[model samples]
Target: MHLVTGGAGFIGSHLVDALVESGQKVRVLDNFSSGREEFLSHHEDSGRVEIFRADLLDMNAVKKSMQGVEMVHHLAANPDIRLGTEVTDTDLKQGTLATYNVLEAMRMEGVSRISFSSSSAIYGEAEQMPTPETYGPVMPISLYGASKLGSEALITAWAGTFGAEAWIHRFANIV
Candidate 1:
């Protein structure tokens, strides 16, 4: 079974649909914050999808979702960049901490594969347009961006430390 965090949200929901269409058993862990149930309502009738409403900050909850999971698609985060500035702890709890919990859960579950949805925010205002993957001196201007960059680091470090494999996809904007 495959696990998707924020699986009720815009991107996650679409991903869940595709996974289920391919006959994959999917487990979705979502707290809804920005994820609307309407986006995933289409999957309620399918036996392939199981939705678990829980915060990733809760390690036990994250662990529960990892059971029998072979791969993880982690997409949960503070979606509002402006709000992240207004509420300083949003990124730490929702983005960074939540990601940490997921990684630990994966470690305990012996799940070795993870895919993360990192954003282009890590670049801040780039000096070089068309930022390459090897772009260095990453300076994120917002708390949300910092959290994303931190999460990326955590994933790679976890991979190096624990022999886990990871795929980090950096997207620009989600419209």
Candidate 2:
């Protein structure tokens, strides 16, 4: 089974849909901060989907969700960008630190593969429009962007140190 964090949110929910349609068993761990239950309501009885309502900040919760899962789609994060500006610690806890918790859980559970949801914001208004993934000297401007970049770094280190594999996607604006 594959575990997807924030599986009830916009992008994550659609991911769940596709996974289910493809006949893949998917388990979702979501705190429901901005994720609506309606997004996943159709899958409640689909048997291919299992939902766990929990926060990634709790390492125990993350570990529990990791049980018996082979891969993780790490999509959970604080979605409100403006909130990050007002609260300095928001991204640190919800984005960066939460990713640490997920990585640690995956490590202990022996799950080696992770697909992290990074963002184009990590490029931080680069001089090169339509930047490539190999763009040098990544500098994030917003707290949200910085946290996502930090999470990407953590995933990279985890992959190298633990002999795991990771796919990081730098997504552009949803709309």
Candidate 3:
């Protein structure tokens, strides 16, 4: 089974669709803060998809969701950059800290694979228009970006220390 953290959101819902179409079982964990149930309503009757309405901040819930999951597609985070600026710690709690809880839960559950949705914002002011993943001097401009970078660091550390496999994708505008 696959676990998609933000599976009710735009991108996540689509991913769930693809997974279901491929005959894979999926478990979605979302808080509905920026997601809507209607997005995933199509899979309601499909027994292949299970929705877990919860937040990543809840450690016990996160660990429970990890049970029997083979891979984790972590996409939950603060959706609004403006909100992050207005509420200073929104990104910290929702992004970085939440990712930590997910990783910890995975560790406790003995799940070793994760695919993280990162952001190109990690490369703050770059000289190159299309920054490569190997870009140097990552300087984030917003709290959201900082949280993503921190999450990336945590994921990296977790992979190295626990021998887990991680795939971090830094996305820009997803039009």
Give the C-alpha miss distance for residue 121 in model 3, angstroms: 0.9
| Cα-based lDDT for every prediction | 0.94, 0.94, 0.94
Clashing pairs in 3: none
Clashes of 3: 0
| lDDT tens digits by residue: candidate 3, 33-124 | 99999999989899999999999999999999999999999999988988998899999999999999999999999999999999998888
Looking at model 2, the pairs that clash are none
State every prediction's TM-score relative to the real structure.
0.98, 0.98, 0.98
- Please give the lDDT score at residue 142 for candidate 1: 94
lDDT of 2 by residue, 1-175 (tens): 9999999999999999999998899999999989999999999888999999999998998999999999899999998878998999999999999999999999999999999999998989898988998897889999999999999989999899999999999999896
Candidate 1 per-residue C-alpha lDDT over 54-107 given as tens digits, one digit per residue, 9 for 90 to 100: 999999999999999999999999889999878899999999999999999999
Candidate 1 residue-wise lDDT at 162:
100
Lowest-scoring 10 consecutive residues by lDDT in candidate 3? Answer: 121-130
Off by over 4 Å in 1: none
